[model samples]
Structures are given as C-alpha cells and as structure tokens.
Target chain A: MNTTSWLNPLAALVLSPLLPGIINRTKAFFAGRRGQPLLQGYYDIAKLLHKGAVYSRTTSWIFRAGPVVGLAAVLMALVLLPLGGSAAPLNFTGDIILLAYLLGLMRFFTVIAALDTGSAFEGMGASREVQFSVLTEPALLLSLAAMGKAGQIGSGSRIEHLDNFLSLSGIYSNLSASVWMRNGTILLLVAGALLIVLLAESPRIPVDDPNTHLELTMIHEVMVLDHGGPDFAMILYGAALKLWVFSALLAGVLIPVRSAYWWLDAGAVIGGIFLLAVVIGVIESSMARLRLLRVPQLLTGAGVLSILAFALILWR
Target chain B: MTGLTGSDVQGHLAVAVSPLRSVVLISGILLVLIALLAVMRSRLLAGRKVELSGTWDCGYARPTARMQYTASSFAQPLTNMFGVLLQTHRSLERPEGFFPTQAGLHTETGDIFRRNVYRPIFQSVERLLLWLHWLQQGRVQIYILYIAVTMLILLIWNL
Candidate 1:
C-alpha cells in the first residue's frame, strides 16, 4: 500500500541482475580481463524470452513447471524480504520460516525437474544440491535467528531460533552500530556463518563452480542443462533473483544503513549489496573450490559457527 | 511462548511460526503462469522448430553409457569422505598395455549400518543355531542313555 512496500518488487526486477554483473566485473578485474557488460544478464534474459524452448522427448510437465514454480517461489520470498532497508510487502510474527521454505520450495521443484529429465548428470547434481543444502539451510536459518535475537536490543522477553520469531523486519528494521557493538561477537559470528550460507546457497565457489562446464563437477548448472530458450531464461533470472535475496539478507545485516528518510537507507542498502557482490567475486578469485569430499566439512563448519553463535546468545 | 527482555521495550522476539502473505504468493504464482503461457503462445506464433539430438559428447565415434561418468563416480569424493561408514566396494579391470583388450570398473556403495550391524547379528544367529544342532541326534540309543543317566542321578539322591 505504501511507496516502500511497492519498491520491493520494483527494485528486485530492475536491480537483481546488477549484483551478478558487479560480481562478474570484479572477477574480471582480478583476472586482468574486461568482462561482459553489466547488462549481460538482462540481455540473456531478453534473448531467452524471444527464443523457443526445447523439451526432451522423455520429459513431462514437471520439467516445464520447474522454472515457473521456481521463479514464483522466489518472487514470493522477495515479498517477505525487507529489501533496501524497508519493511517487507508481506510480514508477520514468523515470516522468516516462510521465506526460507519458499526457497526450499524452489529447490524442491528444481530437483524434481532435473529428475524428470532422466539424465544421470542432473540426478547427480540434484543429489549434491540436496546434500550441501542440508548443512547450509541450518546455518542460514540459525544465523538469521541469531540476528533475530539481536533484534531484541531494546525489547523485553526474548524469543529465539527460527522456531520462535525470525521476522524479516524484526532482524533488519532496527539494526545499528550500537546493536553490533553490544553484541559484536554474536553479530560477527552470525555474519561469518551467513557469508558461508550465502556462498553455498547461491552456488558460488567453495560449494559449486558456477563457471564450470564439466558435468561431473556441476551442481546447479547441470540440473537445468536440458532447458533452452525461455525456460532457460526463466531459470537464469530466477537464479539471479535468488542471489539477490541472499545478498539482500547478508548486506542488510552487514551494512546496518539506517536513515530517517526511506530512500537514503534504500540507496545505502543497494550499495551494500553491490559491495557484497564484489566481496564474493574476490573470494572466488582468491580460492579454488574445495575438493568435493571436503565440501561437507566446510558446510558443517558453518553449522558449527552458527551453533556457537546460538550458544553465545543463549548464555547472554 | 518465551520472550525477550529489554530496558525500554517488552515483546516476544521470534514469532513461533512465520506469517506469510498468501495473497501475495497466489498473485505471484498467477503471474508466473501467465508468463509461461505467454512464452508458449509466442512459440506457437513464431512457429520456431526444435531439433532433437544427443548431447554433444567428446568426439568418440560411438558414445556409450559407460563412457559417461556414473552417479557414483561423480559423487566419489563425497562418498570417500565418509568411507569409514559408507564402505564402498570397487572392482576394476585395467588394460595391461597400449593395445588393450578390455577395461571395466564397477563400484557399489552399500548401506553401512545394514552391512556392519544387521549382517553380523544374522551371522551370529546362524552360528548359534549350528552349535545347537548337536543336541538333535536322531538315534534311539542317545535318547535312552539320556533317560538312564537321569534315573541313576534320582536314585543316588534318594539314598
């Protein structure tokens, strides 16, 4: 109803691709090569929209439904998110669980879609996706839940964990440097855990190699290999949107850009998202993906960090 | 039901369950469906054709399922990470030299708990049954000797 609520989807549509562009540019800088234009994702999506899709002979409606369901789920998730430091278009006492499961819903459809193709590679990727997400999901929710606890900065009677009341606005609405200072260790740990979740959840390096063409090593890419034209485009845009959600969450926490005027805070939050993109690019450039076997250890370590963060908050 | 306490404010911190806007979700789904229909309609209007073919494989004259990595091979690293419990069995036949006859690899990653726990229990039960078979001799003399021994023990006790 309000201008800020209207801005959530508006910003998502126009600005989601920019984060990936920033990341690509940052990676290009580290590699000493000029990357594609920042608008490449937009161009790819447009091209995909114009082209005809190719469905395999063995495929069914499930494959076709994958992108549609996925994009829809992510769209719903965007509604719950308090992007650009504004209250979500949709918010409630416990909206964080809904947001997390919305993404989970996206993943569910994706894996089923991949399975529908009857491709061994897609099945393998689906398995890996599920395995890695098992750890990342807990880390993500727990860290966000920890931030929810931090939201009680000036409140009486604290609720804890995702099972309690991890609201989108509840976490980001009142973030400030003072909040960070009071629970600096807690915030720092949660952020560290969240950074890992962001990387893993978005299929960034260390959990998956987004740039790799080899099927054996693919996780997210291989699952959608059969999709072409508009279908593929939907997947690409959906992924960009998913990345945007994770970035918003991570940036919202790390940037704590609070201003009386809504637009200024929104601008600062957008800037923070781009900055997070650069950080991701730097990380990709600086490290090769972990050995596939060791990925679980890293994810489990993230889980441990979140648990430690949770323990610290409970002790307080 | 639990709550957080603060200097100036008083309220529950985390909501027990996340409240979502079903209307927003329904609208989002509707939009996605419309977009998909539009895509389908455009494809029909444009009459663009699709060519079906095998995925491009490395230029082998003939591509077989064996040439591509199996799911197990693709996930070998992760499986090996938990080799302690997974206990994957591998069988391979390597070519001896440049002019090879045949080479093959088979891998089986079985349920560790079933193998380590259930199999052992069943095996021990089998062994116990085998040991218990000594008492089931079918001869009549064995049965009579058992009864005589019982009667002599009873007579000695009575004296």
Candidate 2:
C-alpha cells in the first residue's frame, strides 16, 4: 500500500505526458514520417508553465478556476485508481462510483466554463460534449460492472478494488475454466466497450478531432480556446493524466500477470500504457471522425454493447 | 300515528347506521363549509387597499402592465423548432404591399406533455385494456348480475 501511494502520483507525473507523445509517434511512424521526440510534450508543458495567461474579457471566475478544478479532479481519480496490480491510495466500499462522479464533476465545470465565454462555437462544442457523455457514461459503468462481476466481486465491490492481488487472481482463475465462458465473453465485450469509451473520453478520432482547427466541429479543443499559458498547460496535463488512468484500468483488466515484485507489475503497467497509445494511434490513423449527427449513434452503439455484456453476466 | 313495534324500530335504526353513509355525510358538510369560507373571505378583502400615497416623493404616475415582456417572445426560437410537438399557433396582421399601415403578430404554443406525450400514451393503454371497460358499463342489470355471480361462487365454495 505504501508503495502504491508513492507510485500512484509518481506514475501519473512521469508517464502522463508520454502517452500522448507515444500515440503521436506511433501514428507518425505508421504514416512513414519521422516522429517527434518522446520528451517533446514535457518541454512544451515547461514552456507553457513559464508563460503568463491572458484572461478573456467575457469570462468570470469560473474560467480561471476551471483548469485548476479539472487538474485536481483528474489527480483525485488517479489516487482512487490502482497503478498496476496494487490497491489505490483511497479505497472505500464504493469508490468506483465516486471516481466516475468526480470525472463527471470536472466535465460539468469544464463545459460551464466554456459556455461562460459566451462564444457560440464553444457552446456548440460544449453541447456536443455533454450529449456524447450522456450516452457514453452508461457504457463505462456497465462495462466496469461486467468486469467486476467476472472477478466474482459482483454484488457491491468497487471497480477500483478490482486491482487488488486477490481480485486479479480470481479474475484469471475464472477465465481459465470452460464453465465460465460467459465471464470470458463479458470481459471481451467490456474491453471493446472500453476501447470506444477511450476514444470518446480523450477526444480522439471517430468521436472528436483533437488536432482539428475548425472551431465549429472541435469538442475538447474548442472548449479551451481562450485558455493559454499555465492554464493551458494544466488542461493538457489533466487530459494526459485522465488518459493514463483509463489506460491503466484497461491494462489491469487485460493483463493477468501477477507478481509480488512491484517492479514487474510496474513494467507491465508501463507496457500496457504503451500498447494502449499505439492502439489509439492506429485507430486514429485508420478512421475519420464520425459525422456530428452520427456520433450519437456511435456512442449509443457502445452503450448497447455494454448492456449486452451485462445481460450475459446476469444470465450466467 | 300508530305506535311502531320495537322490532320494526330496531330494523330501521340498523339500516340507517352505516359506515359509508357517515363518511359521505361528513365529507359533504366539510366541502360546503370550505366553499362558504372562501366566498366570505374574498368578499371581505375585495375593497381593502394599502395606502402608498406619501411613501415616495416622486410625482404621481399610474403604472401600466405593458412594460413586461411576454412569454411568447422569450420562447420564439424553441417554439419554431418544436411547433409540431408543441401545437403552437400564430396570428399576424401585416402591412399592405407598397403602402404600409399598422401591423402586429400574435403567437401561442401549447404544451406537448398534454397533447402528444400523455394523451397518446394513455390512449394506447386504454386500447390495451378495452376488455376491462365492459366490466363497468354503468348498467344496473350488469352490476346485479356480477354481484349474483360472486355470491353464488362464494356459496358453492363454502358448500
């Protein structure tokens, strides 16, 4: 647990920015172009932090406080999540619900702050973000529930607790049996749902285009248009941390390797992060962002997939 | 008048003493008392006015209600998009072509919850339960038949 405490924040601080860089590099390499350095994001963040921010004339205190709350909420989620095969720092009976709600709180504030700028472009982006989120959240929760049920902690166990040693071993043991085909099926379905959620949550392709300059279609980027300097850096770091946390969760479910050696789990966790980044990069390179009208359909498809997984679990 | 026998008087009293009759009588009295109170209170307060004549030094001026904004203008854009759902209506008088005169526009939107959502859902439920409507057709003969059937079933089971 003490190791988990030290490693949780350390991993978030050290590896958060690298995930985005890896994704970009993977995409560049796949496209046959020389990629940016792994440390490029770190340097960019440092430069941003050294500069000053310019406030928008139309914004209120919410605009200034938005990034701060966003960063804090993401960090809090990190503390609630287990880095590898270790328990989180703050484990409670129902911590996973709190974890998801904290992220929701961050999203709510971020959207409101965007709207406070009174820019129609930002408002449009905010509206789309909220609509997509409303469809995406159920998938996230249901998928996590399926994964939890497969581990035999189905009744009321928090998702964050699934990272513990006993729970990890239980999940692996159940997967090895033919009688638990339902469990395996649900696990695979959840992985698929989570893959979609990863795209939706991080503003990746097929849901949002982070690299797009067109203000009318941008979701996450348009919301941060008025932010600069340290505030912008905070937003970037917060997004990176969220990506790392989610990827780590996906890794915890997919990777069944258990070891008493902390370094081994840490290595697996890092490898999982790298693998997720590559997967995301491949997806972005392969597909275009969904049309604005069709994005809802994609999100709803994810929700239905998760519900199917849940129904399979219940049937079993 | 002939003196009533003790047995006849007891049978009449038993018929009059019923829980349902008491409940109906009490509720009827309470309803009348509430209506009377409401009428008397309104009459007593109708002519009363609060004097604000010297409270302000501003010159006397009567205030009109036209300064307020109407709900229609506030919800114009929303009403336009969902006019079918809301059952909105509009009436307008426009100026004549080439030579303009007085012009005005009026619009109103109905609540979709009543017209579209609730009424349709309820109608579908009613259709589904159409058979149950025959059970309560407001016919005395049908009600008497139902009661007779119920009592006969009870008697057969007891036997």
Candidate 3:
C-alpha cells in the first residue's frame, strides 16, 4: 500500500454526506424554489443525534443492529473501492466479491431488522428491496468482472496472472484514458449498467423516492420508519456513504483520469463524484418514479446490459 | 504443490476468509457501542420524555398480532417470482354473502422430491422384498426335516 492510500477513505468519510446535500440542492434549482442549505444532510444527522430514540415495542436487538451494521458494511465497502487514480487502502485478490457481499451483508441486516418490526409496511418494503436487489447485484458483479477483464486486456502484461485482475485496485489502477479509447463500447455498456445499479441500489428518484410520504408506495424508506434519533442518524449517514461508494465506482469508470500528478487524479475523481450527484439530481427533477410493477423490468434491463458487456469482452 | 510456498497458500486462504476478519467487524461493534452511548446521551438531553406507545396502524382502533406481517407474507414477493417451480397449492373460499359467512385462503408448499421420487421408489422396494417372507414355517417338524435333508445330502456326498 502507498503512504497516502488512507487519504481516499478519509475523503469519503468527510465528504459522503455532502452528496445528498448537493443532490437536493440541484433538485431545488430545477424546481425554481429556494432549497435548503448544501449542508442540510449534515444538519439533519446532527439534529437527530441530539434527540431521544423511540424503539417500537415489537422490536428487538436486531432492529438496533441494523443501522450500525449497515454503516459498518458500507464503511468497509468504501475502503475496498479505489477512488480516482489511487489504489484502495485494502486490496487483495477477489476483493471485488468481498465488496459486493459487504453491501449484501448490509442489506441482509436491514431486511431482517425490518422483518423484526412485524409491521406490514416494513415487510412490504423489505420484500421489494430484496426483489430489486436480486437483479441489481448480478449487474453490479458482472459489470465489475467485465471491467476487470477489460483492464487485463488493456494492461497487456505477459507475466502477471489473471487472478490479479480480480481486485478493485488492480483493475481500476490499470484503467486509463487509453483503455477507454480502445474498449469504449464495452466500457460504455458497463458504465450504463453500473449507473443503473447505482440508481436502484441507492434510494434515488427513479427506483424509490427518498422524499416519498406514503408508506404503501415506499420501498427503502418504509423499512426504516420505526427507527428514530441517533439510530436514524446512523441510517441516514450510512445511506449517504452507500451513495458515495457507488458513485466512486461509477466515477472511476466515467473519468479514467490517470494523470502523472496524484493530486490531479484525486481531484478529478472527487469532482466526477459530485458531477454524478448533480446528474442524478437532474434526473430526479425531470423524471418520475416508475410504477412498482415495472421496476423489475428496469433492473433486469441493467442486468442484460452487463451480460452483453461481459459477452463482448469474452468474444474479444 | 511442488514449488509454491506455504505462505502463498496461506495468503490465498487469508484472502478468502478476510471478509469475516476485516477491521470493519471490530469497527462495526465499536459503532454499535457508540450508537448506544449516543442514544443514552440523547435520552439525557430529552429529560425522559421519550414516550412508549403502540405502533401506528392507520387508526385501526386496536391492532393485534394477527394484523402483523407473517413470515410467508414477508417472502410473498420472492415466492411469487418462483411460483412455477414451487407449485404451491392455494385454496380460497370467499364469503358468499355479506355479513353471513367465513372466508379463508390456505396455501401449502409440499416437498416435491418426496412426492414425485422417493415414495414410489420405497414402495417398489417393499414389494420386491415380500417374496422372502416364505422362508419361516409355523411347525417345528418342518424345520427338523429341512435339517435332516441337508445332513443326508452331505452324507451321500461323503460316500
């Protein structure tokens, strides 16, 4: 590991909550209203942290465990990801699978916690969350695998084993502007699939509205309705971090700025992440959420995109 | 196996199991503890006004355990997706007239392998084994005659 490998994680911990703020501000600009401050996400978490929590009578230790586990899992995932042109803090062979399953662990805890509440709304939300994730996870893994293969091809090293390509840092560090120039089509397809995965995995406007009020219509939001105070703050912060993690992965692909200067690469990746947030905000402002039944089709479309990208890579 | 060092295999195995022993696991526990402390601090800030009440059930007056989501209901979405393979049998009886009858829906998921494969094989095996039942007779004289016939055959062979 490099001396400054820890800088990326530090940046993520400090700047992740800013993503929701930026996204909300962009949405407000589109709506022609004076929006909340750019630091509104931070303010909300702080306010929640200062208040008392209310636990449901039906809930148990699992409910309390959800937010903590989710936060920790996302934190772990944040480390596994390589931001900008820098390698991740922790990387080994097959770390990509670990990254994917870390997110899975977060979701599993969230789902079981929701189920523990015994509320019909939470159960419904949990079921929907699981159903959608079924499609998103495959797209996520396949896209990463395709990108790894692409990176392997681009590097053109004769001595290194193929297993080295399976790590996030290995693949991402190898990727540069030239790689994209050579394999633009496959990367484009993978990028599109990953963007869809990001939208679906995070509670964005198209998949599940973060600002939704009706519990019956909610998916991710409904699962955490019973939590309050610091617990809710952990969840909110965890969500922002989750969004950051996905954005980092997508940004790495979208902007393969492998400059000689470390600062330039890092700055470009961070800027790319913020740009993605703005784009997502604009998408939220312009588009409406899909009907509940049609969400599976959208997710499956992402899966198909990933499979096509992988197949194209294999063909070459 | 011939050239690779033990450290190399250990490294590979370590990578495989690293997710479980990650620093995040320890940090996750610490995070939970911190959250607990924060909750306690918040409680102190609130001056003990955190009220305990029943869950909101859309003003249904009194909510019972039956109104809650069951395990089957929780997995309904996934089950619906794999319905063809599961072949879950559902029986629904709707109330014929308003305020007059009972209505119920029952769903049963049986083990398909036992139904289609194991029972038939076990039944055929039982049938094939029934022919061996004729070896035992009720009388002691019949058993003695069999022993004597075996002895006579052995004596003639010796001669």
Question: Which residue pairs clash in candidate 2?
Answer: none
Residue B136 accuracy (lDDT) in model 2: 82
Top of the candidates by lDDT: 3
Candidate 3 residue-wise lDDT, A177-205, digit = tens = 88898899999999999999999998897
For residues B45-126, write the lDDT of model 3, one tens digit per residue.
Answer: 4664565565655567877788788777776777777788888888989888769568888888778888889999998898
What lDDT tens digits, residue by residue, belong to model 2 across residues A1-316?
4764468668777878998898899889889999899887898888876665566556787876677677767766776676555566555434566567768967987887787675656666677777778888899878766666666633234445433212222332223233234366777788788888888998799899888878878889888887777667878888998888778777766764456776677677678878999999999889888888788788888898899988887777
Candidate 3 pairs with clashing backbones: none
lDDT of 1 at A215: 87
Interface RMSD, model 1, angstroms:
4.4
Per model, how much of the real contact set is kept? 0.15, 0.00, 0.38
Q: List the candidates ranked by DockQ, beginning with the highest.
A: 3, 1, 2
Instruction: Flag regions of model 1 displaced more than 4 Å.
Output: A153-164, B1-46, B55-159
Per-residue accuracy of model 2 over B30-128 as CA lDDT, tens digit each:
345435534543343345431212111123353223422234543454455456677777898988888787878877676768786899999999897
By TM-score, the better pick of 2 and 3 is 3
Ranking by lDDT: 3, 1, 2
* lDDT of every model, 2 decimals: 0.79, 0.70, 0.85
**Ten residues in a row with the worst lDDT in model 1 chain A?**
A154-163
